[model samples]
Target: MVRCSSLLVALCLVDTVTPWAPHAAQRWARHSARSANPQDVETARSADIVAVAESFGVDVNSRNKACCPFHDERTPSFTLNPDKGLYKCFGCGAGGDVIKLYRELANATFAEAVEALVKEDRPKTRRVAEVKEVDASERIQLKQANAVAQEVYAEALRHQTSGGARQYLRKRGINPKTAAAFGLGFARPGTARSLTKDMDKSAFVAAGVLYQDGRARFGSKVTFPIRDACGDTLGFGSRALKIRKDEAKYVNSPASAVFSKGSCLFGLDVAKDAIHATDEALLVEGYFDVLALHDAGCANAVGVLGVGVTPRQLETAARFSPSRRVVLALDADAAGDAAVRRLCDDVLPTLADESGVDVVVMRWPDGAKDAADFVAGRREQGETDAAIASAVRDLCAAATAWNDVDVCDIPINEADAASSSSSAPPDDPPPDDSQDELRKKIDELQKQLAELSAQVASS
Candidate 1:
C-alpha cells in the first residue's frame, strides 16, 4: 500500500511497471542484444526514478518534487520518492517507472533509451578487447573489485598481532572470533606502506576502498566493513586509533556505485536472519555497539550510521521484521533526545498505516553514554554472562512508547471537539443537568492534564 500525503506516495518500490508498447517482440529483441551489465539490467527493469529524472535535467528539491515534464507548469506536481525510487505527477497523471519517463522525455523507442543508458560512462582503454570487456560487464567488475578488497582487508586483520587495532579490540573486549566474523581490520599509518598497496589502483579507487587524499585516508584507524543486505562488501567505516584535535574521530568511505550513506544499517547482514526468526529488532547507534550487543547474545541487534534515523532506514527495517518491533537504543545524549522527538512528532504520525509497527524508545539511566559502554561496563563490574544478558533484556523490556499522545492530557483537535460538542437539535429544550455534567467532565480532564504535565516536568 502506498502512503499518500502532499502528493507523495511513501511506499512505492523501484521495481514497478513501465509503459510498454503492444508490439513488444521487436523491442524485446533489441533490448536483449544490448551489452548491459547485470545490475544495469536490473536497474532498468526496476529503475532508479531519481536517476531518470536527473537525466532529463529535473531538479528534485528537498521536498522531492520537480516541475512536470509532460506539461509545463510553474508549481511542481511531479514527486519522486527516494526511499522507494518511484515518481508520480499529480497534474498530468504521468506516473510510471524510470523507463517510461525516459521513453516519454527522449521521444525514443525503449531500445534506444536502454542502449544509451547501458553505454553511459564507458572508459577508453589501451587494449581493445579489455575495454570492450570492461564496458560489457562493469557491474560484475565492481563486485569483483569489492570482493578482492574485502579479502585483502580480512587477511590484514587476520594477521593483526603487531597492530594497534588488535590492542584496541582487546581493550574493548571484542574477541578475535567476533572480529573475524564482522571483518574488522587495521589500516597501517603510512601512505606508501598499506594493506591496499599491491592492489590495482583503479579497482580499489572505484570500489571506494582506497582514497587519493594526500595522506592514506584511513591511516592509523580501525576499519569496519559495511555490507549490503546480501552480505556483499560495499565500503568501510573508519575510526581513528590516534585521535588528534585536527581530525574527526570517525570517518567513512565516500559514496560509490555500491555504498550510500544512511541507506544501510551496520550488522544487518548478520542480524537479518535473527530478526526474521524473532520478528523484532534491537537498534543501536554505532558499529561497535552492534558488535558488542551481538557478542553479548543479542543476535537481533543492528546499528544505523548516523544520529537521526531516516524514513528510508525505517522502511528497510520494516522489510526484515514486518512486526516493526524496533527498539531504539541510541546514546543517552542531546542527539538521542532530538531523535526521539523527531520519531514521535514527525516519523510516527506518518507511519499510522504501517500495520502494528511500534517504535519503542529504550532509555538508559543518565550518565551511561551508549549501549557499547553499558555492555563493557557490565563486563568490568564482574557480572556473570547470564546477568549481563538479563540486564540487556531488561533495558529493552523497559522501553516506553514514544507516541503517547494522551487524550486526557491534551484535548482532541478543535475541529473534532467542536463537531462532537454540537447540540442535537435547536427545537428541543436544552438539558441544564447535562450541561453541568459536561462542564464537570472538562474540569476533571483539565485537572488530570495539569497533574500529568507536572509529573513529566519533574521527572
Candidate 2:
C-alpha cells in the first residue's frame, strides 16, 4: 500500500506533466492509444472501488465511506459506489469515476492511471547507494604499520637512552605511570631509518610513521598515539621537543586511509566510558590538557588537538555523551576565544537543530594558560589531587551555555591579540577612539536601514 507521505514525495520527485485538456474526446483518444484495449478500461471501470481506495491507503467503513482525502473533515463524506466503481467527496465536491479517482490520488495522467488500474507493471524510481573508494587491504596494512610503530615508539620512551625525552614529560607534570597509560612515547633522534628498516617502509610512510624518503615523521619528538574509539592506533600527533626555527611546535600524521585529523579526538578511546558515565564531555585544545585532566581524576576530558572542533568530532562525542553536552575548556587566550565564537556562531546552532546537543563555554581562571597549566599551578600551590579534581569539575559545572554567551564582548582587535600573553596580559580596554569608530559604523548602518525601509514603504 502506498503511504500518503511517500506518494506526495514521489509526485514531487517527478517533473510536472504538460497540461491536459478537459475535453472528453482528446482524453479518450490518448487513453485508447496508450492502453490499446477498450476491454481493459471496461474491466477497470467495473473493479471494486473500495479495494482501489484501500490500495492507496484509505480506510473505508462497512458503509463504503471514508473521510475526504481532498480536504480536511471530521465526518466521513467520501462515499464509494463499489458496484459502479465511483467515488464522490461531498465536502470538496470531488466526484469521479474509478480511473479519474486513481489519476487524482496518484497524481498521474488519464492514461497512466488507466494502466495502473489494469494491474500493469510500472517503472520505479532508481536509488543509488554510496560507495567508498578506500581499499580494505591498504587500510589493514596502514593499521598494522601504525601498531608496530606505536610499540617501537613506546619502548623508546621507556628506554634508558630516552632520559631527555622523559625529562620533557616530567616538566609537563606527566608522571611515568600516566604517560604509559595513554601509550605516550618518544622518537629518538637519528634512529628513524635504523629502527624501521626491517619493517615495510611503504606501509610506514602511508601511516605517517615515516616520510616518503624513509626518515621518521615524528623523530626527536614526544609522540602521542591517535587512536580510534576501539583503541586501534590510527596515527600519531607529536610535539617537537627541540623544534628548529622553521618547525611547527607540534606535528600530526597526514590524512591516510584510516586516519583523519579533523575527525579523531585525542584521548577519546580511554575517555568514552567516563564521558558516558558523566553524561558530559570536557573539550580541551591539546593532548597535554587531556592528560592533565585525566590525571586530576576528571577522566571525561578529550582534546580537539589544536584545531577547532569539527562536526564529525562533535557527533562522535555525542555518541558517548548521552546528554550530548560538550563543555569547552580550551586555552585561556584570544585563539581559544575565537574557537568558542566559531563554534557558537557557525557550528552549534545548526547542530542543535539537527541532533540536539548543548555546548557550554568554561572561562579559564585569570592566571591559567590552559588546562595543563591550570592543573600544574594548582599542584604547585599544594592543592590535593582530589581538591584540584573537584575544583575542575565545579568550574565545568558552572560553565555558561553557548546561547547565553555574548561573543561580541570579546574584541576582534588583531594587534591587541598578538601582544597579549596567555597568563599575564595588561588589563586595559581598547582605546576610546576605537569605540567611537564602531559607534559611527553602527550609526551609518542604521541610517542606511532607515532609508531602505522608507523606499520600500513608498514603493
Write candidate 1's Cα lDDT for 1-459 as tens digits: 011221122112212322222223333343345434556655564556677777667878888899876444568899987666567776644455554466555654444555555554212322243322123145545666666656655666556453667888878878888888887877664422453466566666676666654345566678888876667776778888778998999988886655667667788778887876767788888888888887787788888886878655664565567566778778766676667666665555444332235677775552467878777878778876578668878877777665542213221233443455577553554577855775675566556656656766898
What TM-score, over all chains together, does every model reach? 0.58, 0.62
Tens digits of per-residue lDDT for model 2 on 1-459?
A: 234345444444332422222232343454345442567777667767788788766789999999876444568999999877878876544566887677656655445665677774331212153324564567778888888888888998988999999999989888888898889998887657655666767778778788888788888899999987767788899998887998888989998767878778899888988998998999889999999889889899989878577765776676577678888777867788778767766666555643466778886674677899889989999998899999988998999877566545544343345455334546754467855775676566556656656766898
By summed lDDT, the worst window of 10 consecutive residues in model 2 runs over 15-24
The worst-scoring run of ten residues by lDDT in candidate 1 lies at: 1-10
TM-score (C-alpha) between model 2 and the true structure: 0.62
Task: List where candidate 1 sits over 4 angstroms from the true fold.
Answer: 1-139, 189-199, 213-215, 352-356, 405-459
Clashing pairs in 1: none
